[model samples]
Target: MAVASLIPPAPATGEPQSGCYMAATSDCGGRLSREHYISRGLIDGPELRVRGMPWQREEVARFSPDNLVARILCRRHNSAMSPLDAHAIRFFLSVEAGLKHAQRRSLSRKSRFYMTSGDGLELWAMKTLASLYSSGIEFMTPEHRFRDFEPPMERIVAELSSPNPCSIMTLSLPLMQDAHEEQIGRRAVSIGPIVDDETGELSGLLVRMHGIALVFNIDLPDKDALPETEIARPDMIDLIGMDRTSRIFLSRAKRRPEAWIVQIRLSHPRKDPPAGRSDRGCNRQPLRK
Candidate 1:
């Protein structure tokens, strides 16, 4: 689709459009600028760009409301708060193609950011891996899974991929809020494993990511109070205390991965049996047991 066709006709000079868009919220401040759901930079980024153009425009155009969607925001919100929105939009674009790219890289580089080899973690990661796995929710994907952890990944992904549920326009705050509430009780309420080095055993709990649990330490108070010692199994990660400055480390094997599959790409050179062949897989097919 022509880039111009993707962009909505410019609101005639100053005439504002209806605020019916639910993704838009009323800003008491002033007129909002036309924000590209996907960052213009990302549209022209290195990994995704080809010949100075995004190959995914065709895919993104499908989601673009008139080539671009406009939401009313005050200058503050648009410039300040909108960074999150901008980042999220880019992530959505990346994951569509990046997921495959990330997976290929994992096979070689091995990322610790959103992967685990333990059986218990397979189910958790499969369920929560899609959401931003970093301690803080910075990234987002179109497949924002882990909204609820009670259901299995297959069930949830199947539901999400359905045409009815996949439309971005159909999503609203109330719906998202409702889904979040439902998952509160069922969200992964435990830390799977903790792999730590000399910088004190990094202890973090697994919260839902996309639809998986990414184990990262929470930066809370009293980090200095915990004993700086090493532990064996990740199960012992829980033993560590939570405190301020409880640094959360997101370890990614390859900074530039080729696909998005979340599983430990064993880096240990000792290939006794093989890599990606962990004994602690789960009964679920998503977990690869």
Candidate 2:
């Protein structure tokens, strides 16, 4: 549980104004490199057109380099995490293919995909969360304390450099239906607070990329401590050898655009309690459809 303070104290007067979000020490030297919010290699093909939430608009548009690029990490730190980007790309590609296959089958059947490097994928999720958080630092004010609040940069850097699977939990699902398509892309990356029945605080980060949604929860509580009704569990197909699997299902109707349903099943079998749990933990917000 080596966690870093999400927000660092304001930088010193004479020091460099910005530093690498991952490393938290190396000054960009007034030249910060562009880091893709979503890996470029993952969306290079035509089928997967990139889309992002526009700053002022209520809709999502084709993602442009400027829209998704963030000048957060220095050259050295950015280069160090390249392998993670590649692993994440591969992991998502496998998932996309599995979803496509499930859709093509047009049956209420189950599908499972293996992740050879779960730690790598977890780090990728953490990196994306950190990147999104850092990109919006300028817009934050004292009143926006929730937005400014985050785990420490040093801890994040440590996780990105040497990820620990026990530190954070990650789950992924596909956007099967277009019912919320407009809102989905508009909310590409969002970080917020999740409060439990006892008013305990936890952080939630959601990242949607290429029709897939990845959700991360820090310091999740044990499942057995909460009632089953207060927890949301999706049907998951187990991956062979690995303890966890990314499960997907498609509706029987071939003509329906909402035929697909995807979910990320973690090995731990526990998740952060649902948002807004009353004293009895009777009412809970839906984690996903």
Indicate which candidate wins on lDDT.
2
Candidate 2: regions farther than 4 A off? 1-18, 23-31, 46-58, 105-116, 137-146, 162-202, 209-213, 225-289
Whole-model Cα lDDT of every candidate shown, in order: 0.25, 0.44
Tens-place lDDT per residue, model 1, 59-154, is 212222233324433343335333333332333333223333333333343321222222222222222322212112222223322222222223
TM per prediction: 0.26, 0.55
Candidate 1 overall Cα lDDT vs. reference? Answer: 0.25
Among all windows of ten consecutive residues in candidate 1, which has the lowest summed lDDT? 236-245
Candidate no. 2 TM-score: 0.55
